[model samples]
Target: MTVTATRSRAGVLTGVLTAALVCTGLMAGIFFAFTVSVMPGLHETDDRTFVTAMRGINAAIENGLFGLVFVGALGFTGLAAVLLARSGRRAAAWWAGAAAVLYLLVLILTMGVEVPLNDQLARAGDDFARARHDFEGVWVPVNDLRTVLTALALACLGPALAKRTAGVSR
Candidate 1:
């Protein structure tokens, strides 16, 4: 490839990787918030209040702002993976691709497992105590999984970004 074209490709890939890093950090922050603050706060509340609050929060998060951040993070990572796959720097490619795949697991677990639990809790009505009792057991652990995965993705993307910059400098 021409020098200009190669530089452009690296630039775009770097942008994507940076975005992936930001989004993943945001997501990890959200989960970490739940882990450290939200859930713990809920644990102190009455069961009814806990259920109501969780249901409302989950419902509110279904909006555009959250959607874009969540999906954008994944999309950028996936694009970075594709762009870097053919890069001459194998280290950059490997880390970028791994970040994409790691975040995919976070997406899958959110949609497949966490969403279902949220739905069930929403439908629980006056059985708030029981619903929450059942929900917390499964939800909290899975959330931690996503949180860790997102953090790991961030870790991988960091190195990938550094490698991209190094390539440009050399």
Candidate 2:
């Protein structure tokens, strides 16, 4: 390929990767912060209002099928990165690939472990004690996976951004 054509392709790939990284990074941060800061407090309080909120929150977290969306996004982001890398954006590709792997593993933990536990919790119905027990035992670490995946995405974004800069310079 001509030098100009190669440069143009790289630029486009870099732009797409940058946009994806920024968006995914923002989502990860928002999710992690909400899960960490707010979800915890929901568990700490046991007043009627707190219990109501917890039940509502649990339903929202589980029944909304958020994980399906999350999984889809993760797949798209990884595919984009692969395309970018194949087109010559190695750094961005590497970052996205790493983040994708981490996300996949975390998602697996969510589906295989957390979701079933959520089912158990939901079955507890108005039995707050049983629900809380199940949540504490299983949900906390699943939530921890959320935080870890977010951090992974954030970390990957840094390298992806650097690659964009380097690609522009080259």
Candidate 3:
């Protein structure tokens, strides 16, 4: 490829990688906030209040903006990996690939574990104590796992973006 073509491709890769990083960072931040503050604060509340708050949060978080960032993190990271590999930036590609895999795990865990718990909480009737009992133990731990995974994904992307920016192809 010509120098100009290569530069253009690299620029596009940079944009995609940047988007991936931003989205991943946002995901990590959200989970981290929940881990540190939201859950803990809610933990101090009564059972019914906790269940009501969680149900509200689950419903509110299902909007378009949240969905875009949540899904886009994985999409852009995977695309960045593929593009880097195709361009022979092997090391950066590997880092981005690892990030993609990590974020994919986060997605899988969210859908497989957390979402089901959320659904159960929503279906939970007037027995707020029972709902909180079932939800908090499982959801908190799983969310903590998600938070760690997302942070790891962000960490992996950092090196990838740095290597790309420094023009380190190998």
Q: Cα lDDT of all candidates, in order?
A: 0.86, 0.66, 0.95
Summing lDDT over every window of 10 consecutive residues in candidate 1, give the lowest-scoring window. Answer: 161-170
User: Candidate 3: which pairs clash?
Assistant: none
Q: What would the per-residue lDDT of candidate 3 be over residues 58-170, giving only the tens digit for each residue?
A: 99999999999999999999999998888778889999999999999999999999999999999999999999999999999999999999999999999899878555464
Candidate 2 regions with alpha-carbon error over 4 angstroms? 1-12, 47-51, 61-69, 165-170
Q: Report the C-alpha lDDT of model 1 over 1-92, residue by residue, as the tens digit.
A: 79999779878887888888898889989998998899888989998999999999999999998899899888998887777766666677
Q: Which candidate gets the maximum TM-score versus the true structure?
A: 3
Candidate 2 steric clashes = 0
Per-residue C-alpha lDDT of model 2 across residues 1-170, encoded as one tens digit per residue: 89999778767666666655655665577568757787677667774445466557668765334555565547656776777566566776777788777767766776788677666765766777656766665677677777778678667766765664455221
Of models 1 and 2, which has the larger TM-score?
1
Which window of 10 residues has the lowest lDDT sum in candidate 2? 161-170
Q: Candidate 3: worst 10 consecutive residues by lDDT?
A: 161-170
